[model samples]
Target: METLLINEQFVSQFKYWREGQVRTGMRFRRNLFEYVSKFNHHQRHHAFDLAWKLAQAGKESIVTATSDSYTIWVNLRVVCPAALPSWSNSGLEVGAFEPASPGLVPLEAVLSA
Candidate 1:
């Protein structure tokens, strides 16, 4: 439901979360959610902030933002419609969420397993 207008800029910067990779969870890092969510305003504010922080810390961060994680957070945000301003568009026309009929029906909802 929550939409992440991952512009070409952000996508271009994210060279790590490419296709066909897997994360096994052998990490021992700080809690990204707590740190960044304290400031950002969006559904995945914590997740997104933490991901960026992890990247800065030089950990194998691309895994933090696998397609699965991205999707889960985005969906949750959409459902809850968090108070984070980052979740919405700015300048009166930010190219982020495209409002739909009530709930956001996932483009791949049928495939969710």
Candidate 2:
């Protein structure tokens, strides 16, 4: 699990995401998730970088992994001031398997997402 610290860059990302989500009527854009696999030290890094980006955008993102490492969960709490009244937190879960070797997770995947 990781927590993104709110800062100027984070605020900028947040604003951009929010602005893009606004529509003429009662519609919105879906959150983007551009993910890649990576290794942390020697372990498989199966977490999604979008969670951290969402956190930076004032959306609290919590990630959890089971003991067996077969499943992971992403829980999000969106509290942006520009959001609609009916908006609520979102969650996602994915199944994962251990890799034979390490993998690469790029920063570009997060920025471009």
Candidate 3:
């Protein structure tokens, strides 16, 4: 089984996004980069790696930013599955849950176990 760890910074940023209070595009980009960088350097999760690649490629579908505003189309729960329960209970769009790898266990399964 795989263990997923959700850091305080990830939870804080996720709350900001969930509340639609990300403020400016610059802030959003900065937070995204910081989270992705930290995850890559420490955890090396595939979801975060994918996010980093997409961000570097300037994928508008995942994120778009301007001087005043920004939009994040990516579902951050992919990189932070530990937040899935909170997201689902809050009636937010949790999106689909698919394990990044066959060896990776789903959050629901882990919780149920």
For residues 1-93, what per-residue lDDT tens digits would candidate 3 score against the true structure? Answer: 122233332322321232332311112333331122111232334334444554454432232322322223333334343432321212222
True lDDT of residue 99, candidate 1: 21
List residue ranges in candidate 2 displaced over 4 A: 1-48, 70-113
- Candidate 1 local lDDT, 1-113, one digit each (tens): 12233322232111111124221111112211111121123334545554454344343232223332331122221222233334322332213222223342322332241
Candidate number of the best TM-score: 2
Q: Choose 1 or 2, whichever is better by lDDT.
A: 2
By the lDDT metric, which is better: model 1 or model 3? 3
- TM-scores of all predicted structures: 0.22, 0.26, 0.20
Per-residue alpha-carbon lDDT of candidate 2 for residues 1-113, written as tens digits (9 for 90 to 100): 35422221211112112333421111012232211112232232434354455555565443323333212111212334444322222322232233233443332343465
Please report, as a residue range, the 10-residue window in candidate 3 with the lowest summed lDDT: 33-42
Rank order (by TM-score, best first): 2, 1, 3
